[model samples]
Target: MFKAGRTAAPRTRPTSMKIAMIIAGTVIFLLLGLPLIVQIITAFRGPFLPFGVSSAQWGVTNFITLWELREDFWGVLGATGAFVGGSTVLSLLMAFGLAWITVRTDAPVRRLISVLVIVPYIIPPIVKAQAYLLMLSPESGVLNQLLRLLPFTGDVPIDPYSFGSLIFIQSLTNVTFPFLMMVPILTNMDGSLEESARVSGASWPKTLRRVTLPMLWPGLLGVTVLTFILGLGSLEVPLLFGQESGKNIFSLKLWTLISSSSGQLPQYGLAAAWGLVFLVITTIAFAVYLRATRNAERRASVSGKGFRPSTMRMGGWKIPSMILVTIFILLTAILPLLALLWGAITPYPVAFSFDAMLNRTSFAAFGTVLADPDFWVALGRTVVIAGGSATLAVVVATVFAYGIARSRKTPWVKAADLFASSSVAIPATIAGFAMFLTFMVLNPYIPLAGTLIALIIAYSYRVSIAYRSSYSATLQIRPELEEAALVSGASQLTGFRRVVGPLLMPTVMAVWIQMFILGTNEFTLPAFLAVPETRPLSMYIYAMINPRSAQLYAPDQGAAMALIFTLMVFAIGYGLQWLLARRAIGRARKAVAAPDLTPLSAAPGGGGEDPSATVTIAVAKRRARARVR
Candidate 1:
């Protein structure tokens, strides 16, 4: 009877567990999967639907019309190709140089340069566009004025509104993403291969050419593909810089088709067609990216044994290299910030002469911004929405990751993982459009559109992939600890809360901060879903700079708002860093004070336990002590 009872209990538990996993997986699929399904249906519904209409007759007319609009379509595709290619190449070269210098060379002020390299990414891309516009504007640019003062210089050659200028500015902003991606790969790479080549009579340069670059090929390819995809989908940079120059890309074209300044009805079906085309392109690129990443991971097999790379001494080139890097940082990071400050204070764009500085600077624009009650209300609304969205996203992602991690043997979990991972490849414009249609057209009874809740849902869809990735990595922690807790008479939920949660806290905190920053800076979804009362800071700044708006072309006021927004983001980021640092230090101190339970087998006249056994016993003892306390 007892043997039969034990067998039955085990079978029953597995069945229950499988049922729970199935339910959770189904919910996640519906939440994320339904939007894409709706988008496809909407695309087949053709370009015109009556107002407040939820249903449309299915046809292939939208695709046919899109094919007929080949002139505009081809032009946008060509421009997108050039922009994505130029930005990707330039960013990769610059990021490689910076990463090599910081990670492998003995350069002066390397730490400062390392910190400054990420500044461009930290500032929102919209603000980056505004800063360049201030500095490179042909009529009132400070840099152009300084150039005109030079001998034999008639007019400044820089054209801020040109396609070349668009690529240059966008490259500066996009470089940091690849830089961050490459630094760790370069830093942690095994140096034994290069050292062996050098020892075999190869010169340093030859060794690097033969050994280092080859080993880094996979990583480089992965970063290149990823950055190119990002550049392909970028909207704000091209929207701000290329819109006036008649250099529209696919994203901008999609935006124009769906949003009419002249009060013409929006061509919803045409926009859907563009999105479908873009989706196909992104899907192919993303597949390539995935393959490259898998290859990189497979190739990155440094031995577990300790081995540190040797740094190259720059000799006489150190100072010069450092100076060059410093100048680049100043141009990319500091100059943009200074431009924002200058724009905020001046009555209008002015040359950076001493007279202009002394006569034109004031706090009037900032004061005007501060005095607007709508500005305050918008700021408050943004804080709440961004904060709430980030928190909710972290929770949902953690739950989803937990389910996937614990149920890895189940086919349902595998399907869930694939769906969540593939979500990242969807462009923000497409995701926003899908969400917009999902709520506003397909399920209007839900009442999510034009509210903060809708914005939260959109942001979560965009950011949950990041959290899932983070949590999945952390979930690699062995399950033995949780099993130990279970054996000690705790329920499964209690074991997770007590044993796993604390261990995962650091990763959870990091994900929360990342999601918070992404939500704060997000613009695309808010543009699609946020009503006027629920607009975020990104939309607020966009309105100030929008040419069609009645804000009197106040780039100065927009600059002021940008400066404030940047400071707020910086503060939140640094504050969290400080708190995490302090928490880590506190843990170190507590660990130091804890009793050392080194096995007695290591002492004289003690029972001699095997080394492996001794280590296991010590760990068990420590855990027991922790439980007691």
Candidate 2:
């Protein structure tokens, strides 16, 4: 007993875990960050060394001059910041309301409503913007035409290029993030927490403010920080909707540096400088968010168990909720879809009227875009890239999650879990840019860089955290089952196949489908990654939308393509969700139906309540608020 495990040094265990999380964190940081490092290192490696021989001279001279000369850089930075702040606030507000509607009330078709709410983001922003342009562009857009028809419009100039309009558009694309972010939080919360508050003379508003919000703080912090970084870093929304408003943001500025035909030496150095600045700003923000969260946790832990989630019976509000959710679903899911459909049918000669909606010309553009070879190539690239990446990510996350969640004594195993989850807070664009630079500098020998493989790697790395979270939760399932199989002399792989893998298969499928849909919509990464030969469909759509491109940006074609993509991804995601739901519900049904295990009577004076009754079902499924506490 030279070293009983405890005496062997607990320090090594946590240190190993820390290293794993740190490596994972570092890899994520490299996704967007390492590019600037590579860029700087490359500049220094050049004949005319940047900074100096010691690498210290790579400093302010380049940065100050560019910062002085490039007004667009500053404008883009400001616009990104403003849009991120504005959009994050607005989207979270909407999400809270919608979350409340679906989670708290006995809203009819609640799951359907929730599904439809998320459909907006599933459609590419490029396609979504195309539809909005058709509906709201000041000249021929549907909204503009309708506005002009009104009696009071003679003096009005309804520009879609307004600051307010840009903010509104950005808000729409981002609303889904908060919705997605809040789902797990809301669903896991125990209702008894809120119920306890309600029974103690806490008015509804008061209970929500005093009881619910504190619990939601972590999600709010995490989501807000994520939104801010994306907002600050994103160039897509501003490029499309904010362009006319003179809203040049960092992402767009980066695009200009890389894409514009500036006769010679197109400002790579300056772009690199901006990249570094952005990375610094983002890093600082991340630090602050982490600090804020830690502080909040310290405060909240003191009163942690005060409020539990409880359901509020909607005496008369149930039908009204159904009606409201139906309208919301219609507005978010149906109306834009209707626009796409109507746009698709009008053929041959495009007309900008209600009658044109039926004109035959709209159909031609759909045919035109689809028949284009670029469309097929881009679409094919998307599938291969997303499919390959998501699969790898799921596998890595499964291994990592299993090791960490099941670990009895190992430190390194826990580290992997911590690292995998940390990447969630990092913005995708940063990760994309970071990977771009990383490849440029090192292991350029590998065929993966800047090809479809490069895209896969980036997507896989960014998405790894997501799968890790989902799988880690799932990995908590009893390992005893698998151990028993091993004890029965089953082979390792056999035990995995007959025991562990079967149980995890449904969850792994869910993560895979989800990652695929998300991977398809990663518009920015592809923009940077696009070569003439291997351009992703997302970039293809953006090119189509460009005023300069020959590809059709006509509403009918664009919306049709958008809807096609949306429906495709929705089918994949919902398919997995349905499978998971069936498995979970069947297990739940069996658990509830167990004859010997009598649950506490939910009736007055504690009589046994029917397990299958609607009220009990509602209570049973009501999201717990334990996390909130």
Candidate 3:
């Protein structure tokens, strides 16, 4: 097959292109990462207000402030660690077992189970808190109400506000995440890699321990880091579900600083300092995770193999295990909606019965909202602010992702990737608080002190990682199609519009919708950045949650609000999925003009199809081809 040909040396690109890329990357990093850096710096703002953005104030004042209430502060931090650890361990076990069952087994009803598992994750956190409250409220809880009706054991309420309940709810709500993470890796893994270990007489547990565990350790590390950071930075579930009864996470302690009645004027500096401390813990975790996974590489275990994945092969564990998992799902996802609908229809101090089902469907739950101008103002503000911010973030992310994927030949691409992904390590709370501090100072320049601009920047930076990941995949499609149009006399912009833009529309739309849902469901950032004039729904819900307000049934009001929020999220998700399907059909119809090259196998040794044979020639050829490569 050798032919006489002269190969020319590769052409070199101009140095200016690389220089331009480097500058772009540096600028992007500075923009996203500067706030965290500033938080660390501003902690030294020296026992004073206005924590000036100067090196002079960059001392240890804030860190010391944390220890001033040494016992309480440290105790809360301990509680934070406990919450993170318990939740992490539980989520890991749940995810691992569920992933194994769904991926490896012929678990009956697997499809429905998989979908239901993710449903709770989509439920708003406040909604979850409300449902738990209804069933576990100290005195008039549904559980207590039921106990009273029983002939025996009627003396007490279940009281699920302890550290135990906090762990239970946080862990249960997060199990869906690890399950989602494992699916892709499990699917892409080669069956053969596991087979080799099995053939060498490894028992199932041994195989998992020595072979699969080692290989999946990187993923485990990544997931664990994410879970730990999430819990450490958490505020909602613990704040609402935990009692002063032996559990107080750092986030709660920070809340005490803000909302504790005795404080003179809001001490932004101390709260910011606490936020900075939380950021420090997460930063250390991120650094450790980066180090641990630094050398981890993808290992493919199977190619063409006769080995079918082993099914769950449940001997006696089926029914009991099903009962356990079902109970959890029922409580977390199913009960929440039922409870929400019930509370929305019922008045405050609700007593329960099957007869309550016969009560009139009240528009009153929504009626309260109708009379309140703030409700529509908040809803309209949510649409205009959150919706617009999410869209802009996606656009910026798309451009940023394109710069990295297609234009990485420029020096700035590395910087863009680092900044975009680095946002993942910075929780929304820290970013929001950082911006809160930064805005207070920068307000002089842009008058951003109380506007949506501050919140928008915080939200965009926080959600940029999702946008970058989604857009990066779309950008990796071949550029030759666009280049051909340009060469055919189309302008550069026209070529992108005609070629690249159409292909990216699916991901662009998806990122927009997903970010919108994430933004709306988000509570913590809005708590910090959203104010009375431009408040979001989460903050509105927060006001209702406080017992001091005229509205004592805060849980019911929030549950009603949350139910509406959840429907809005699903509407967006379903709408995007439908749009994506339609786009695919349209593209397929238009592809009739393109030639089909089915006769030629593309990849080397991609061998012909096997019409028959338990042991096919195609497998041999494919294996041989892979080995050669």
Candidate 4:
């Protein structure tokens, strides 16, 4: 007989289930994957007119234009390389440092550092860019103003439009991502090896370099690939500062190609070519990420035996470490926020001044923004669009992830998984361009361009994120739960609804919360899809600060609105997160207090001992080993 708790592998699934899987796979592909395919095809075809490619012919014409534009393209490519590479490396370094300090050292305010580092991740890049513009704008900026007062300082001390500034701000924004990813790895590391290294005369630095870092290569490699690829698609930093510094990047170039000067037609073919190059880069990066993660099990440092994480004692360096972490917190969280608050309360044409803040500070800007009917309308649209997209994305992602977990070997399932996850590599800029083309093509039949439906579809691209989370959660759960329900005469759908659904609800809610926040703050997709009538809050704020929008260029107003927007998102996001954490704790406590009713030995195929008995035997073995040692 088969081992206890193991079900017989089904050779065939029901035809209805097969049909359902196929339909689900098709829907996911059509939504997430088709855009990339369209861009690839459009690259080879002729120019995409306002209507369609009806008069276009297939050739290397776009590639020819790409070649003709090689000078501008190469300049942009170099700038992009510098921006993406610098930001990725810097962010990874900062993240790793913060993770190490918080997890492995006796750093001050470790809990506070952990919370503050993640705050920047939720702040919109546009908001950050605006704040920095006020804080570091060389002439009128707050920091520069402060610097000019120094006795030894030059006339201009800091340049916000420089590559260094761009990299620093961008890195600050995303450093929390790798920090979060690295924390568990650092926390779970076995300390015995480190202690042995110390016994063998290796110093802390050498031990970290030779022992700890080698073990962390796989994780670092994965973080590097993802962060670099993400940097390539970044729009706001490069858009705001790149051209100002004569360092244009690919995303900005792509946007210019689409929304060219009034007299010029959009260079759709060249934009497609540029996007294809980006795709190629991300595809290679993702492949490397996969290859590195494939052997992750080998790098696993934790064990069933007593596992202790290494903690470094900072006798003399603790204060310096605290200072460094404090500076990081100031840069990543406090400074930008303070700048925004200052800008919001100050008069129009905002300037940083304590004098103005104390004397001229008025709540009028807040009132002005709050009282605007357009602001209310935009806020409503943002809530609906972000909430609706997140809900739809989570539902589709759950179905796709469930299908992937249950039928990993199915060809359609494999394809769907690839397509759904691949969107992570597709930058929002390229995705927006593709969506624009798609909606324009279908405009005659559907008339969706410039509509709320278009925004919803565009924003729902967060499916990849939800899919990854749900897929991992699904795999952790045992198939026995569903099978037992099936044995009790429950249909497959009923088993999922009655058994697996509750189990997965927590993960589903967390993913929904994350996607909702992301969709709400997302700028690139809505910029491409939203019209005046359908503008979300992000778009509205963008219009306000945009210098080109002469009629609406009110940086103070934008600052006030963005401040309120940030507070609302933070409250909703963190409040929901707190609730989810509480729910999770409640469920875990219930699980512990409940009876061990799982069918470990009484499973249909069971004949021998229970699984708990094996665990008991292992515990005895471990105890005996401990006694012998």
Could you tally the backbone clashes for each prediction?
0, 36, 10, 0
Model 2 lDDT vs. the true structure?
A: 0.63
- Candidate 4 per-residue C-alpha lDDT over 209-273 given as tens digits, one digit per residue, 9 for 90 to 100: 99888888888887888788777767777767766663467788888788854468888878888
The lDDT for every candidate, in the order shown, is 0.75, 0.63, 0.67, 0.79
TM-score against truth, every candidate: 0.89, 0.75, 0.82, 0.90
Runs in model 4 lying further than 4 Å from the true structure: 1-16, 49-51, 261-263, 350-354, 408-415, 582-629
* Local distance difference test, candidate 4: 0.79
How do the candidates rank by lDDT, highest first? 4, 1, 3, 2
Model 3, span 232-318: residue lDDT tens: 656677667774753467666665555535556555667778777777778788888888888776444444655445454665777
Best by the TM-score measure: 4
| Consecutive 10-residue window with the lowest summed lDDT within model 3 | 614-623
Instruction: Give me the overall lDDT of model 1.
Output: 0.75
- A best-first ranking of the candidates according to their TM-score comes to 4, 1, 3, 2
RMSD of each: 4.3, 8.8, 8.3, 7.6
RMSD of 4: 7.6
Q: List where candidate 3 sits over 4 angstroms from the true fold.
A: 1-31, 49-58, 143-154, 191-202, 258-262, 302-310, 355-363, 370-373, 407-415, 482-498, 551-555, 593-629
- True lDDT of residue 91, candidate 3: 85
